[model samples]
Target: MTRSINEVRVVGLGKVGELVALLLSDSGFTVTAYDARTRSDLPFACKELDVRDGAALRSALTGADAVVSCLPYHLNLGVAEAAHDLGVHYFDLTEDVPTTNRVLELAGSGEARNVYAPQCGLAPGLIGIVGSWLAKQFDEIRSIELKVGALPRHPAGLLGYAFNWSAEGVVNEYLNDCEVLRSGRRQMVPAMTEQERVVIGGIELEASLTSGGLGTMCETYEGRVQRLDYKTMRYPGHFELMRFFFDELGLRDRRELAGEILVQAKPPVDDDVVYLHAAVEGHADATGERAYRKQYVRAYQPLTINGRHWRAISWTTAASAAAVVELVADGRLPQTGFIKQEDISFVDLLSTKNGALFGDLGKV
Candidate 1:
């Protein structure tokens, strides 16, 4: 019988990655954290390992049961390939579609040696699970809409934003084409379009179509759901300014330089809010309530962990990733083969040690 995951190697020690390591350690997993820069004072074992070096990366994963790639999306493919070659369970928080495709190719079909689960963070991670769980509550589902945003609570200038996360990731999402299920068919739509007003908790904000937030949901619910889309909510007028900056100024091609400038201007903030809003429209049952909608919406605020305060985005994303790993380690999830976010049980996800940070799954 395959042994449950107990030893984990976490690559990259950024804000979110560091938190993932902390959570896993607190949950009783022997964690080894790695990063390019040497750091000290962390509770768990921390090392400076160059993930770009394939030989060193594999050597580092020598005895680990699982590896979580906290590296950027561009670097995740190589890490995943190394994990597959070593038969170590692989997990990542990548939203890049092409990267995910390559990872899927690495892990074949059912009955694999180890697990390969990616896109296990905030929007594509938690949101996907929530949407799927809500869909299960209905007999026939028509639509599944997911929207999320991480922004500064206070409004500022025209952009009204802060670089709470990766600027490169943000730029990619803004420029890349999004996959959505429209009219019961998978369709590719341009990002930053489909602007609409969204009111959550009576705070009027705007939502625009964003890429990668939907993950593989478009393919999973292609023919079954009439409409399936994911959007990023922001303060009203934020999308318009972004369009002018990226399109009107022709900074789309210069993504790296654009990200640098944006981060310089709107650095990161301590007080940030993560908003998650998911709704499923369908029939409650065959005979009762032919048409109905169920929604899960909440505004996540900063939380204190281990006597230290963590930003909302950091804790939410980190907790989601750690929870997924916890489930896999606890044998609550599939022990092998690829796992889809939508296939993960939302109730179980919330019940996990780290996932408890997401709060209760609530009534469907």
Candidate 2:
């Protein structure tokens, strides 16, 4: 006899949350969506919930097997803590280091009965998985470089940038200190530093230091690789304009203003591009000869899914978080405890129903 499947609660009513809800609901799991707004339209008993209210959140999680939080990074810790208390597996798309660290602490405690997985988005999510897979291919990894970006498919502005993702998160990355492993030593670098122009498949993009993009990689590969880092990609000339604003104008300290200005000036668009680039250099165990090379290119492809013609950015950003939920629900991943984005194998991720977003990554 088939066992009765438990319901999965998806918090946050944003685009990503909606996609995650749809994917999980289609996968045979009953999904209950909750938002901070007045909870209604309980298509499956969806409720408007104040996720911060511990008592209410725990009550909402009754009988729920899992909870996937699509809330912004700032509200992630509260949700994870509640999930831990309620014995429901938890997952989120947080890219912030401090928030992730708190989640790790909560998960590390033996009291946490269920999984607490964070950093399930694009850069910190799939990028880490793919990077780890690349590292395993070499005998001894010397350097690993990762670059990712979400941009407008067609630019209509001078900056050529669009707010396809969270504007606050983007500003945070620009203002925070970046963690990078240089010459085999981990160090914190200033954001927007070491700018470079790179061309991928005839498409030129800019890359530079950005905070929190290298989630768990530095700690995972510490003292092992000669160099390791993650960078954010953007269109050419974007860096110059940002440097002028954040540096010369001293807007780095003014996060709210930066976020407001960005959102006000650059509206989000459906037509956008998601770029991923990774490279690793190491020697084959048998061959002691010098082996030094890198893989560098940009991926720009329009994609459509779930009756929506979402560009690469929307599909990827949404798909990464969605796939993790599917994996957990299917028991392909751990149901509880602290889980890293790299914890899930690439092959396993590609095999999921929503995994088509990755397509054939080719041989990197």
Give residue 355's lDDT in candidate 1 (0 to 100).
Answer: 81
Give TM-scores for every candidate, taking all chains together and pairing residue i with residue i: 0.97, 0.92
Query: In candidate 2, where is summed lDDT lowest over 10 consecutive residues?
Result: 355-364
Top candidate, metric TM-score: 1
- Candidate 1 residue pairs in backbone clash: none
What's model 1's lDDT at 1? Answer: 32
Per-residue lDDT of candidate 1, residues 1-364 (tens digit): 3439989999998979999999999989999999998779899999999888999999999899999998899999889989988899999999999999988888884447889999999978999999999999988889998999898988687899999999999999999999999899999999999998888877788999999998889989988999999999999999999999998999999999999999999999999988899999989865488799998998888888999999999999999999999889888899888899999998998798888877742221
lDDT per residue (tens digit) for residues 252-348 in model 2? 8898898899888998887677788888898866556579554644475656555667557656766777777777766787766778886687778
* Alpha-carbon runs more than 4 Å astray in model 1: 1-3, 109-111, 360-364
Residue 236 of model 2 has an lDDT of: 90
lDDT of each: 0.90, 0.79
